[model samples]
Target chain A: MDWNAFLLSLKLAGWTVAILLPLSVFIARHLAWRRYAGKAFVEAALALPLVLPPTVLGYYLLVGLGRASPIGQLYEGIFGGPLVFTFEGLLIASIIFNLPFAVQPMQRAFENISEEIRDAAACCGMTSWRKLWRIELPLAWPGLMTAFVLTFAHTIGEFGVVLMVGGSIPGETRTAAIAIYDRVQAFDNAAAGAMSALLLVISLIAIGIANLATSRAGARRG
Target chain B: MADRPTGLDARLVQDAPIPLNARLRCEPGEVLALVGPSGGGKSTILCAIAGLRNIAEGRISCNGSVWYDSEKRINVATRLRRVGFVFQSYALFPHLSALANVMEGLGSGRNGGSERRARELLELVRLGGLETRRPSELSGGQQQRVAVARALARDPEVLLLDEPFSSVDRATRQRLHRELGHLRGRLRMPIVLVTHDLEEAVQLGDRMSILHHGQTLQEGAPHDIMARPANREVARLIDLKNIFQARIAGQRPGAGITALAWGSTRLEAGYNRRFAVGDLVDWVIPSGSVILHRRRRPSRGIRENPVHGRVESMVRLGDTVIVAVKVDAHAGYPLFMSMPVHAAERNSVAPGERVGVSLVRSDIHIMPALQPDGHDDANADP
Candidate 1:
């Protein structure tokens, strides 16, 4: 079943979620409340990954993080390694592609919060940090849960970006989706079918959890 | 109250984001009502006082401290300013219990005695036993009380209520009004109330400011503003509907009367020296001051400003009946008056019936016309 590759996929998804969800909260909050010039442009730029082909995005990231690039040179100077074909590179690719999935739901949730409620919180003598921790985070819980689940599931099932940014390397960057593809090319139909079934079950469970969170949020609004 | 000037004093002027050119002052233990139509900058003024909204040129001072000073380039953050704001929606935290909501205003469980203080505040708002209930579980009035308790927990320098009674039912609003009136006696801070309902302002405000088109037209006692508005716009805003164009005939200082020429009739009003002889002006009188002559016998008091008219329209609303009378000399315009239903019944007042009405002389008020000769045709002799 390529268990090592499956475990590596899980690890990559977990890291992507852990690093992106918290950061998305702040970014989503800023987008929700602020009004400025070119706000729609900024939002469209952030959502570019949703519509662009994964290979296209991967090509840009590959060139940007290659050994000749300034970012790649800086990373090598810090960690003594190039960044294009390792698990870390794959993690970066996963985070970038999952940005829309992580941000849009949380932004909608933050926007649903009444401005009067936030004003009342400030009038109650609560500092901005305390208000965010006590009021905003609790009210936006469902969206956070939805963002976490979707990002994890999407990162695990990613194929094109992973193949482009991080080539298949056993116990390193070879993920479950890549393993299924490799098994099919080798005429190992039985292994491919079993791994595909596992991926389907996992995807269904993640979607179910995400829908549950969304419906709960909808009920609160209703 | 403190010895020095220790209440809210603000003058805000800005062009965008809800235009405002308002000046407000409320002494400690006093309530100032900002009454105007919708989108007239009432709520914007309240927000400016709370530091929730900014102004281009203004200085807001409360309790002898500067909250915002444009000249000095100082603007205090909302939280740092000691202000309690009750929104129009009564925005209580839906997830928190009543006690926790009140405790949140006490620095969110920071003070040593916050819990005890919160409980006492809840009790003060008459929500003692409902401490464990979330906002969703409570009724509208109960939620408003919780919001009020939370607002009071911080012991703010000024209290800003942006139509706190607007969202509740009529009965609940009356009860809240009475409770707020009682609560006002115990509060030692300036309170600014924003409302579009003139009756609510009259009932709650110690002084009222009339705003229109982002400008404060006048500020005075509620009754005074109603009885004697600053201009035609103020009169119209307060719903004083018996406005008419008149020419000043003469001012009898010795008799304490100002004579006005209305069509072919001369009417007497209380002495006002501001308008010179032959000057054109607009005048208004309260609907309650128009007394109908009794059918059986006329009193000497009803002999003043006697004018004959036919009842044009009569509308009965609650305990009062509004009667519009078309004067014989000026048939185009109608004079409106409100009388008790029982009085209307006693006089047999009905549409198409001839009636004699005497406008009370002392109640007539005069102000400059908004548009010169706007309604001059209506007041011409028929």
Candidate 2:
């Protein structure tokens, strides 16, 4: 396995999560509380990538942001190159593909918080931000941790979208999921097995730790 | 403590599944028990007062400051309204310990002193040693106390309680009542307590407001309202189950007595209204106001408001004994009477035995007969 590609994969997941976590939380919180026209449409749009083939999403991004389109040309004018097959392109693809993975759990968490607690805080004269930081976030800690872990793990497993948008550019877009496929196609069964096993172990540990922490938090609430 | 504690004045209207139009007031240093049955807009009144819910019309003010004025289109947000609201569920933050829950109400203004004030409040509620426990770890009563402490930490101008004691056990409710009575003395601010329990209202309210279906039927001191409900509905709400349909026999306006025709007999009761002769009226006397005589006293000696009767049924509850007596003079319904067990023991009262029951002259109250709508005054247009 190429250590550079492995390191780049971790970096890609890290950047994708760093950008998506806060964005998803805010979006999910708004969805949980507020009602407006076209809300259902917006929600369905956000969740579409979850069920859509990653290759299809990647195909749209590849064309829509590929220098020939207005946004792509505008970006190219600034950066002197098209967005496809770039590290930045891979991050954008990963964020779109994993949007629901970051939102649904957090939204459910916020919704699950008892209205009594919210009313209590409001009546007691706490500011909205204080209520969110002091009461809501702590109580919804398990869901937040789960959302973060899932987003990170999902980004690590980017295969089709990464292939379509970031096209195996060695250090730029060769994530672990893509790297294992590359090794298999090159007829190196030993390398493919090793990469696949490593990825599986890491993903299991990430989810297991999140699950264990969530149960601990639930017990404390009891 | 505020030198001039805030009083409350509000008139709210809501046009929803059920229309509501309520007007209420409470002076500083007073507990106005807002009493009614479930779904009678008791909680709605409290919510409107605290700004937790909005009203379609009318004004809300605390002392001199107008919190909401629909005409002016000036509505203060709930966070801006200086109100301490204790919800029925005692909504304590589950993740925060008791002390921290109280401290959260102190706002960002008190950084260093919040912990001390929160501790002082917990100690006030007698939860000093258990300050570290979360709401889930505390008993229902303790959680309610914590919620109270948290609400008061803001030093609010108005206090609203939404059946704050309803969830606790009977023993805990009694303890909480005593604690609330004590708190009232120190609070000295306007309080609006929503309760479906009539006994609680009578015991704790300096003044009581009786509501039905979102409209306030009557408001006065508890005893005054109880003795003189505006209509039959108000009478029923106050647990006055012994309403008799009596007609006006004669009027002695200067003597303050309106003679009423109770089934086959005439009895004169203290009357405030100038009810004309021959006009029908409903006379009410509370069950506890009836005095049972061991034997038939002579018609001349203390015969005022006296009726010979036979005991029909008896129920003993602790120190209190409730007896139903069927009067011989009237073929009408039996009169339910409640007296102390000792009083009954002295009279040796038993079911199937004959007895004499009379009203304490001052206890007999008379009201205008029910109109078709059960309202003394004509109702609004349909």
Candidate 3:
């Protein structure tokens, strides 16, 4: 296994988690607090990627980022090339594929917070923005971290989305999971086994760190 | 207390058309307890004055400044209104320490250090050492003290406490009550306390107002309210145990006369001009006002309003004995007469034994029956 692929996988997971954390918080707040028309529809749409086949998501991304499409045209116009079959396209696909993993836990966390606490903040005369930044976000930090971890781990282990959109571009888009698959396809069983072992260790350590952080937060709240 | 400004003077009207009008001028260092049942709009009144609720009609002016006015479309946000509010649930930030919670409202401009001011306020509430603890780490009483400290950090002109002691244990409630009494003495701001407990109202309020169905039924000093309720409902709310229907038999120049016709006995009572001849009126004799004797004794000063009865039941509460008397003369209901436990024990009175119940004419408060619309203007006085 190439060490570069492992490093690239780690970088991809890191970027995904960073971008998804704030987005998930915003989505959770909207789902939990705001009342809007078509909320149910919007929620269902956001969650569609969770159950839909990864190949389906990858296919949609491929077409959306292809030269003919608006997003693809904009990308090509800005960056001088199509986004399909590129590393950036692979990251986009993984984000979409893992969105539900990022959002669901956060939504549940925000839902469990009693409205009495929010009303208390309002009565304290804090503005909405201040309340969100100072009160709600701080209290909801553990759930946000959980969402980030799940999204990052899920993105790291993604194969189908990368295979379809990234086309196994070595050291660029071929993450560890995709590298293991390629090794297995080429009948390099020894290399595949080594990459699988590394992926397992990384994922286990990520999960352990996440659990420790969450438990510490829980103790503080308690 | 440097001639502190008058307290809350506000009228509130919600989307529901009935306007809740309140005009109060409490001196500095006064505790005004607003007592009412749930949904009587007691808390709503507090919110309106605190600028937390929008009023569709009328104005709210506190400390000589207009906080809100619907007609003029003038409204001040709650934070800018300079009023402190303590919620029933305390509303302390769970993530913040007790000191931090108190300091959160001190606004960045206070001359002294924020921590020092927070500590001073906490000390005022007797929670000086609990600064590092979170809300969940403290008992209900401690949490409420922190909330009170937080409210005081703003140095508000008016402090609004909504059932501040309701969530604490009885023992803690008594302690908080005493602490609150002390705090009221030290602070120059007027405090408006909302509660549904009559005893709490009496103990905490310098002057109390009783609200029913979104309208104030009566307002006055606690002793005055208990002794001279404006009507039967007010009497009932104050726990007047003996209410009897009587008819105005006749009217005299300075005092009117009425006959309280029970089943087989009739008692005479002195009334005022508010009573008309043949008018059906209800009168209340509070349990504390009833005197009970074991043997048939000669009538004393106000013997005209006297009746004989058998003790139907006896219930002991603290040091008082509440005895229910079966007055066969009163057709529909049995009369409840109360006696002190020591008096009952000295007289050796028990249930099913005969006793004489006597009340003074001054003890008999008579009023016209409640209107069919249930409109009792008992809260008009402050």
Candidate with the greatest TM-score versus the true structure: 1
| Candidate 2 lDDT over residue span B190-280, tens digit each | 9899999999999999999999899988999998999888877788888886777777887787997877777677787885565788777
Q: Fnat of the models, one by one?
A: 0.75, 0.74, 0.36
Model 3 residue runs over 4 Å out of place are A35-38, A63-68, A74-80, A122-130, B1-5, B15-27, B39-41, B44-59, B70-75, B109-112, B255-271, B294-299, B372-382
lDDT of 1 by residue, B1-382 (tens): 6577789999999888778889999999899999999999999898888888888999999988999999999999999897888899988887788999999988856465899999999999999999999888899999899988999988999999999999999999999999999999999999999999999999999999999878999999999999999988888888887888889999999999999998887899999999899999888888899999999888897779998999989989999999999889874478988999999899999999999999999999988766775554323211
How far in Å is the alpha carbon of B125 misplaced in model 1? Answer: 0.4
Clashing pairs in 3: B216-B379, B217-B378, B217-B379, B218-B378, B218-B379, B262-B329, B263-B329, B263-B330, B264-B329
**Residue B333 in candidate 1 has what lDDT?**
74
Docking class of 3: acceptable
lDDT of 2 by residue, A14-92 (tens): 8988999889878988898788999999999999988889889989989887878887888788999887889987887
What is the per-residue lDDT of model 3 for residues A156-208, given as tens digits with 9 covering 90 to 100?
A: 89888888888878878888888888889899999999988988887888888
Q: Which lDDT tens digits does candidate 1 get at residues A1-222?
A: 999988999999999999999889999999999999998998998899999998999899899888898988998999999998999988888888999999998999899889999999999988888999889988887888889888988988899899998989988899999999999999999988998898889889988987887687556534
Q: What is the C-alpha lDDT of each candidate?
A: 0.90, 0.83, 0.79
Q: What is the C-alpha DockQ of each candidate?
A: 0.65, 0.68, 0.41
- Each candidate: chain B TM-score: 0.96, 0.90, 0.87
Off by over 4 Å in 1: A205-222, B1-3, B110-112, B377-382
The candidate with the higher DockQ, 1 or 2, is 2
Q: Candidate 3, residues B270-309: lDDT per residue as tens digits?
A: 6577767777677777776777744544446436467777
